[model samples]
Each structure stands twice: as structure tokens, then as C-alpha cells.
Target: MTSTAIAIAAGGGGDVVAASVLAQRLRHRFDVVAIMSYSWDRLIVDPTPGPRGLGDFDGLTSHHELVAQVTVSTVLRGPGRSTLPPLAHYVGCPLLLMDPVGGVAGLAAQFGAASRVFGAQTLLVVDVGGDILAEGTEAGLRSPLADSMSLAAAVRSGLGLHLLVAGLGLDGELTPPELTSLLQRHGATEVAELGAADVTRFAEVWNWHPSEASGLLCVAADGWRGRVETQRDALIDITDDATIVYEVDAYGVAANSLAANLIATTSLADAEQRVRTRRGYSDIDIERDRVPALARHDEWTPAADTVGAIDRYAYAAANRGVNALTIRRVLELAGASGAGAATRLRELLKCERPHNMRPPLYLA
Candidate 1:
């Protein structure tokens, strides 16, 4: 095993929370090198194949930039109408953000260089749900682009790697049965149970930011089972196996046809286009393209129409299971306009946690 371990959330957001739990565990054995995720988000404007590092995400005009790291030390207010659960609010000492630029293969080189800087001998890429192993045709699959892209990059990264699928089926992308079948078919073996300790540890960070997957995983570890409403599909069944953690060689699991199909993909847009084409999706990223946040912008004034679209997006973002890129689409659908529409939509949204909701007292 390598002394320095790099933990990457295969997908963004709450998936990082799962990775953080694993990193906490690894700290006892190895040098926890760094934790990172794609600058992309399924909830906000982050789609469009771009590189984010040093000069990134300052004001929301998306583009490719240098391979620098953005360290988040503060919990600035979140989007008021936001409904997505976070991965790590504690975000360790300083969470590192590794934007996926230069395509999958290029990203692998970036990983290799970073691994050297951090002295990482091993790389562990984690995804909360098992969809990272999906064939892409699965019915419940909605966001395979990011996971697949990361896996492809990691496989090509030339670093020691292990793939951990934590909180299987929690994302509701794959049914309970679909996940198990994939694992078995791909030669994945049960490494250990994420267990109550992992849940308890994660619960420390979850309360300040409730995670649909973490919330479900915590209770499920205790044998609680039922269904919960999701932004996408109606409900997902919570089986006792939700807490089980499985491990497989990165190459073996990435062999899935869905993921393999992405090996030749040149850019995020190309990968997304492939998944959508295979799935026959026309309006998938179309809405995202329309969303103002996903597009480039200037410091312009906000118009009433633009404000109206923003209000509508906040309401629909969590309810409709809209992808991060669709904010402009929401604005367009709601009749928002002007170059400032994107600027205004961003300026206006504010996240206010429910007063009745409580924070996790166990993290300490």
C-alpha cells in the first residue's frame, strides 16, 4: 500500500462526504494526501467541459483555466433554494478542488503530478452510490458523465488506485438489485462494512448540511428500511445492504461497457453527448445550456424577467431533479432574459436552513 493516499470523490457534492468518511479512516494508517472533486455540480452551473484550478469560479462565468487548487476554508452561505445534500461541510483542514480539464487522459497527468507533490503512493477514488459502475443504460441512471469521466482519468492517471463504492444505491441512480449484480459481475468483493462508526462520524458533519444519501445510510445501518422521495424518481427502496462497502480494482470495475464507452471521449461535453445520445436524451443538457449560470457572463444588471426565472429555478431545482447546467434553461423556460440574467440568478439565490432542523452533535 502507498504511504500517501489521495481520496477523490468520483462524483461531486455529497459523494465527497462519503470520501471524507473513508479519509478519516485512512488517516490512522497512511498519509492522507488530498481530497478533491470535479468543480462541476448537479445543482448549480458547473457543466461544460472546463478546467478549474487557480483562477476559477470567482464569479460564475465558466471556462477552462490553469491546474491550480481552490481551498475552501469558510462555510459561506449556501444557496437558499438549494436542496442538494453536501459531501463534507467540515471539508477537512482545507479541501482541495481538482477541476477536470484537458479531457480524461490529460486529467490523469494532472493527478500524477499532484500525487508527486503530495507524495501519494496510492489513489483511492470513491463514489457514494454504485452508479460509477453502471452500464449507462440503467433506468435510474441520470448522472454517469462525471463518475465515468473521473474513473477514466484515474485509470489513465498512472497512480496506484482502488475504487470504493460506498453507500450503494443511496443516490437512487441504480436499483438495489442492479448494484449487487454489477459488483458480482465485475468481480468486486466486499472489503468491509461502512458500519455505525462511519455513519456516526459522518453524522457529525451531516446535520449542518443534510444529505439524502448519508441520512439514508445512517439509519439503514441500524436495519431501518423504507422509501424516501427523491428529486428524480418517485422513491428508492432502502435495503439492508445499503451500508455495505465494496472494493474492486479500478480497471476491473471500469470495464463496464458504459464506462468503457467513455474511454475514447475527448471532453466533458463529448462524454455527456455520448451518454445522452445512447440514452436518446435531447432536453437533458438543453435545459442546462439555457440556464444562465452555466454560461459566461459580465457584470451586468439584473432584469425583472431574469429575477423571475431565478425564483422559479430555486423552486424547481430541488423538486424537478434538474442538472446543474439547466439554470439557464429554467430561466429561459420562465422567460428570463438579458446577459445579466445569469449574473442576477446567481446574486439572488440564498439558502436558509430550517430552524427546526438540528446539527449533528457527534462529529466531535
Candidate 2:
């Protein structure tokens, strides 16, 4: 079967949520084969330095294999547990993780191998935010290495990959005006907007992962295009374009920025070194060598203490909008699952906006 892999730019998780919306928007035209992502999810999972390359996994496999890859134990780390690949199995999307070990060339090779295995005709590296198009010098641009590296690998993959930037500026990395202007300069053409079904699917993911960015985009997609206030940061006037999924030729975006040069010219470490040299801080460098986000290490404590973990984690999930995957891990860490856990989760969780108090869609 002909496949089209949809890879979330940075580490997976919420990005997969965005890609799920994008895949539905594509209407199953392709197999949507492997849902590719990096292992470096710093938001919920502990931040590792570089991406947990393919080495961190048991190579490529089918959807069922994907589920087996990220067991509940794998997702739930105790107090000190840090990095874990996206609980992609929860969304029922098979995942492919690009290791940062080989730099651009290595990632390209990995992409090729996975594509060949899945018979992917086209590869699309998706970024939830439009930061994939950033030129690295943009003041607001923080994590350019992953996006730029994906862009570089797509170009080098020789597969003529497509680039999709959804919910532009919703990440607060770059404003909508800035992204639109960047695309215009890069000569990007308007591709397509998420359809009604697409919006419905997007809403499902948004409900579970009530992040500030995707929430704003979902609100916009549902026809609210005003400046939405969050606890922190400036009010962002999300435009109609927030729901629009824009694509550009990988080469064009690379040609427009010197950031692309770093990925193309140097190894992953070298490229990160250069960005750190210029930016004074590189998330890749710091996170690559960093510990697990949860800091629980691998072992799980007894079920007795799990109730406590559930209480604390539920509050964080409800109040902070930590996303569904993290909540699932919390449940797992607490030695909880199924209806009983769901009951505890509902009772413990606070805040009801977006109905995050309910069990996650994965659990439901």
C-alpha cells in the first residue's frame, strides 16, 4: 500500500494531536503510515538532551507493534521519571522516532529506511507552530534545531518531502503576521484549510491536550478569531489562518534562512554548538544531556502511594493543561487504570473549561 508518513516536527505528543487533525484533513488519501516524531518532548515528559533516536526504540514496526513499544509502564515514570516517547498508541497512530544521533544525514537515512519499510510515497514533516519556517535569528525562535533538522533531512531525504505548519503562531514562537510574512518571502503557496471533519477531529485532540496554543487554534477554527487571554503572555489575536494548514517546498524555506545552513553543513552537535554560540542557550544542548522530565527514574512505587500521585497529577493536568498523555502516565504510575482510575481522575481533577476534568479520550 502507498503510505504517507506524517512526522511531528519536535518531540511527539501534542504535535501528534495536531497531525491527527492534519491526517483526517488529508482524508486517508495515503495510508498515513508511520506517525513520525522526535523523542524529545520537554513539555510533559522529562527533557532529554538530544532526541531519543531510533536507537532508543526497537526499530520500525506496524501499529500493534507501536502499541507494544510504549507500554503503560514505559509511559508512567515515578517521581524522578523523565523522558518517554509519546503515548502515540493512545491515539491509535503508529509512530516513527527520528534519532538525533546522526545529525541531518543520519535522520535522512532513518527517514528513508522507515519510508521504504512503510512504502511511504510522500513524507511530510509537520510543525504545530510555523516555527519550522523560522530563520533561526528570529528573537522569538527558541527551538530551531529540531525543526530545521527535519527540514534539512526532508531536503536531503531525496523524497521531495512536504512541509506542513499548522496553528501558526499559536505556539507563541512566532506571531501570525511574522509567519505569513516569512512564507510570502519564502514563496510558499496557499495549500488547504482543515475541513469540517478536520476541525471535529482537531477538537477531539484539543479536548485532551488543552494547551494554550492548540486551544487558541481550536477556538479560532470553531469561529472565534479574537485575542484570547491566557494566564501569561500577551493576548494573541488568532486569525482565520490559525486553522489553515500551510505547506511549502522544503528547499524554499531552507533557501530563505541561514538556519538551514547550520543543519545542512554541520553534525547535530556541531549545529547545536553554533546555535548555542549565537543564542547563548540551546534547548537541544541542555535537554539532550538533561535528566527525565518526571525524575522518577524507571521503578514504580506501590499502589498505596499511587493514589497520592493521582491527586497531585490530576490537579496539574486540570490546572496547568498538561495534556492527556501525561495524565495517563500519572495514572499508570499510580497503578491505576480503567473505570476506577477514571473515577479518581474525575474526582481529583480541578477546572472544567474544555471539560478536561473528564477522563482523557485515550482512556475513554
Top candidate (lDDT)? 1
Model 1 regions more than 4 Å off: 26-30, 44-54, 58-67, 73-89, 201-211, 218-225, 282-364
Question: Per-candidate RMSD vs. true structure?
Answer: 8.5, 7.7
lDDT of 2 by residue, 166-198 (tens): 777877777667887887877676666754555
TM per candidate comes to 0.68, 0.69
lDDT of each: 0.57, 0.56
Which stretch of 10 consecutive residues in model 1 shows the poorest summed lDDT? 355-364
Candidate topping TM-score: 2
**Model 1 Cα shift for residue 119 (angstroms):** 0.6
Error of 1 at 218 (Å): 4.3
Q: What C-alpha lDDT, on a 0 to 100 scale, does residue 20 get in candidate 1? A: 73
Question: Candidate 1, residues 63-130: lDDT per residue as tens digits?
Answer: 12323444333222332211121343354632555555455765676677667766777778888878
